[model samples]
Structure formats: C-alpha cells, structure tokens
Target chain A: MEPAVKKGPADILYDEVWELARTIVDARKQIGALRPSKLKTKNVSAALLEMDEIVKATEEASNTIMDSAEIMSSADASDAGYSALVQENCSKIFEACVFQDLTGQRISKVMTTLELVDTHLQDLQDLLGPEFDEPDDGVDEREGDEALLNGPALTDEAISQDDIDALFD
Target chain B: MTANKKDMSILIVDDYKTMLRIIRNLLNEVGFKNIDEAIDGVTALDSLRSKKYDLIISDWNMEPMTGLELLKTVRADATLTKLPFIMVTAESKTENVVAAKQAGVNNYIVKPFNAATLRSKLTSVIGEF
Candidate 1:
C-alpha cells in the first residue's frame, strides 16, 4: 500500500486559483453568449434595435399629426370645434412621446449589464496571467480622469434639478 | 452683451446620438432654435472655436476627451472663458458636482431629465426665457 501524501499550502493555493480561473472563464463565456452584440438565442441587441425602430416610427407619426393639425388650425376659415379637437389631439401626441423616455431607461439598463460583464472579464484577465500584450487603449492610464465620469443615475438614486439648484444657492 | 434665451446659439456635446437627439428635441420644446452638436470633446472644442455659441451643454463621459475636460479647456481659453457651460451627466455624486463647479460649469443636470428640468437649468444659467 502506498503512503498517503498531504498537499502543501502552495499546492492547495494553486488548485484554488485554477478553479477560480475556470469559473471565470465559464462566466465570461456565458456573458458573451448573452451579450446584446452576440446576436445569440437571447440577444438584447435585437430587442433594443426593435425598440429604436418603434421610437423612430412613433416620433415620425406624431410629428406628422402635429404638423397637419397646425396647418389645419391656421386655415382662415378653420372650424372652431375642429381646431379645438386638433389641439387636444396634438397634446395627446406630445404625451405619447413619453415612450421615448421609458425606452431610454430600458436601453440604459441593458448598457449597464454589458458594462458589468466587460468589467468582470477584465478583472478575470488581471487575476490570471496576461495571455496577450496589453493594448494601448488609453483607458487604463486614463483611470484618473474617469473617477468623476460616472454615467447616469438610477431612477431611485437620481437627484432632482431643484436639489442641484439649491446646491448653488 | 447677453444673448436672448430664444435666440441663443447653443452647442450640445454628447457621445450618444440618442441623447443628443433627445436634448435637441427638449431644447426645441423650450424654444431654442439654433442648436449645434458634437459627438465628443475634441469635436466640441473645434465647434466652439469656429463659431460663437451662447451656451454649451455637454455630457461627462466621452472617449478621448470628456465634458469636464472640455469645460476646463473652455474656461482656460481667454477667448472662450466665461462661456455659459452646463454639464449634463448621470453621475449624481457630490464630488463630481463639486469638481464641475470648480471647473467653472455654470450649472449641472443629472440624468434622466425631462424638458422642464432642462428648461430650469437653462433658465438658471442663461436667464428667464
């Protein structure tokens, strides 16, 4: 019977590191597959593109309706009742523009998800040995300026324009 | 001489075309007719040099040069210093606000914002519309 050999701390640490590396690789693959630009089974890019089209179409339709209404209202012999109705309809079209705001929020969320995945992949690469020469993307050295470059605030965490105004006061 | 709010020549700098369009539309709603756009700070600086804009509204995060960089550049330039500059960003951090203020930003707006918020910011920086 062979004697049992106990693994040293270095050996145990190596195993743990390799395990982490594998898990990171798996996570990277999953994120890449799910990314919007991937165009895979669950592509978020497609949904965003579809929403973009919808927003464009809706805006165009709304603008056309508003233009026609304005022309009709300006006519010399425009009926008072019809003019009022046109104004009301135009107001509704303006309100319907709220879709752009909602869609903008959704697109921002998708962008955040993609950014998180990218950061994780970068962190993983840093943990492991560099596989390739580091490119001069200018981002790594530019970290100093990016400290205040935080992108849009989440709805719940966002401050109001009034609050900002009070800051100056 | 201060430009009238409605007639003010405005330059809007943002990396996102969607955001530029949204801001343009909001500006239109608020009666600003003359609006120009640049996709980044470098381009924005060029636009500022070529033409005189009554006001500048810029986003904070852009490649090559950021809105803060742009603001600092405008403030440093003898010709462009004192330009009414507004910084629009999603970052609501106190440090960022202080940095922008120290960099000579006339006002700061945090996203996502509506036409009313934009109007208020514009009014505060420029004057009553």
Candidate 2:
C-alpha cells in the first residue's frame, strides 16, 4: 500500500505561507541577479540612483518580513477567536504586499532591460533604412501588427468611414 | 543607468489625487520626465485617446471605471495596441493575478510599494535593467 500523506496544522500553514514567500524571494533574486549586468549598460550616475532606490526598498521589505514573522509566531493559530482571524488576515496582507513589492521591482528591471533592447533594435533598424521605422504605414500592415499584438476585434459591426468622420465632428 | 536621454513618458491614473501625485513623484525619481496624471479612468481614457503615452500606470480599483476595464479599452484601441499598461492595486489574491494576466496587463504593482519594488517591476515588465 502507498504511504499515507500527512500534514500537521502548523506544517500546512507554514507551507502555504512559504509558497507565497518563495515567489516573492525568487522574483527579488531574479531582479538582483539581473541588476549587475544592467548597471554595466547604464551610466554611473543613473546606476547609482537606481542602486540607492533598490537598496532602500530592500531594507524596507526586509523589515516587513521580519514583522510578519513575529506576528505569525505570536498569534495563537489554534485559538478560534476574532484576534486570530485578524492575525491571519494581517499575515495574508503582508504576503500580498511582498509579492506586489517584488513584482514592482521586477517590472522596473524589465523596463531597463527593454531600454537596452530598444537601443539595440533601433541600431539594427537604422542600419536597414528609414523605412524600418515606418514599416507599417499602410492600412494592411498597420492592421496586421495591431491584430498580431492586441488580438482581434471584439465585434464585426462595421461602419462606413463617413460614419466615423461624422462622429469626429 | 546609462543616460541615453530618457524618452519614456508616464501617465499615472488614480482616483485619489494623493496617489496620483505620489506615483508621479516616484517615476520622477526613476529619471522619468514628462509625467502626466488623471484623477480617474474616465479622464485617463480621454487623455489616452488624445495623447501618445509610452506607458500607462493605473490604479486597479476606482469609481466609474476600474483599471482592468481601462486596460481592456486600451487593448481594444488599435492606435494604442503596443502601449504597455500596468495595474496598481491593493488586491494581491492569487485569483487577482490570474485575472490581470488574462486581461492583458503587461505588469502589476501592489499598493504600499517602495521605490525599489516599483523600479524592479517596471524593469521586469518593460525590460531587464
């Protein structure tokens, strides 16, 4: 027979909490790992400014985590009371904030990376011709890129160009 | 950060004036100039229709129109298809993330975020910085 699975109350709670915690941690680690290479591409002054913001945010998030841990440890998980409910809710709030904060950090990092990518893409595009920048001025090409990026229109309810023009007036 | 002359313009939309101002200031610290603000999604939609914004950062929960609704509208507009949109919210439930991802949000930010977190999310969503 297969062995029976077992998870204690504290074990379950910890697991749940840790699952979210791990997401936050892993995301932050990714951002941290990406930063050094990113800094290489940016100017010193800009890097310094970004580094300062990152450091301050890191410190603040650390404090929040510590506070959450303290709260979780002190709260009576077994107690079927209102205070316990409040504690649980508060704990969830903290975890959610952690994820949000981590995501925010990650987004900034991604943008910087994109900036680098855009620079590289622009360089490549420039090498081709002025047309590279205006690749889709035609209605069909413009429609194609739009549809490809944003998906198809919700409805097929068509209106004439004069109908649209009249509304513009 | 290598100064290649920051070209991005951020339009922050929130129901709360305080929140709008705060987000704008935070973007400023990130070396972003040409920041604009709107009090709610209605005003935001108007601004979005008339101007070309490189980025649209909006609060998720608002009166009349929420961030998700605005995001949907933005996605529907062919002129703004490639524009990156982010939803800033106090809701962080797992389902919320799933929903936002489904609604075509390029990224998300939770309320009470500090400078680093904000910067990081922008980097991850927009590029690797």
- Top candidate when judged by TM-score against the true structure: 1
Query: Listing every candidate in turn, what is its Cα RMSD in Å to the true structure after a full C-alpha superposition?
Result: 8.7, 27.1
- In angstroms, the error of model 1 at A25 is 18
Report the Cα lDDT for residue B11, model 2.
85
What tens digits encode model 1's per-residue C-alpha lDDT throughout B78-107? 999989999988888777788889889999
**Candidate 1 has which clashing residue pairs, if any?**
A152-B90
- In candidate 1, position B122 carries an lDDT of 85
Model 1 chain A weakest lDDT span, ten residues long:
A34-43
Give Cα distance to truth, residue A151, candidate 1, Å.
Answer: 1.5
**lDDT at A112, model 1:** 69
Write down the TM-score for model 1.
Answer: 0.58
Local error of candidate 1 at B30, Å? 2.1
Residues A22-121, candidate 2: write the lDDT tens digits: 9878766755554645555564446456666765665555556545554554567677784765666577556746655664775586667567656655
DockQ list for all candidates: 0.34, 0.02
Candidate 2: segments with Cα more than 4 A from true spot: A1-169, B1-5
Query: How large is the interface RMSD of each prediction?
Result: 3.5, 16.8
Candidate 1 clash figure, as a count: 1
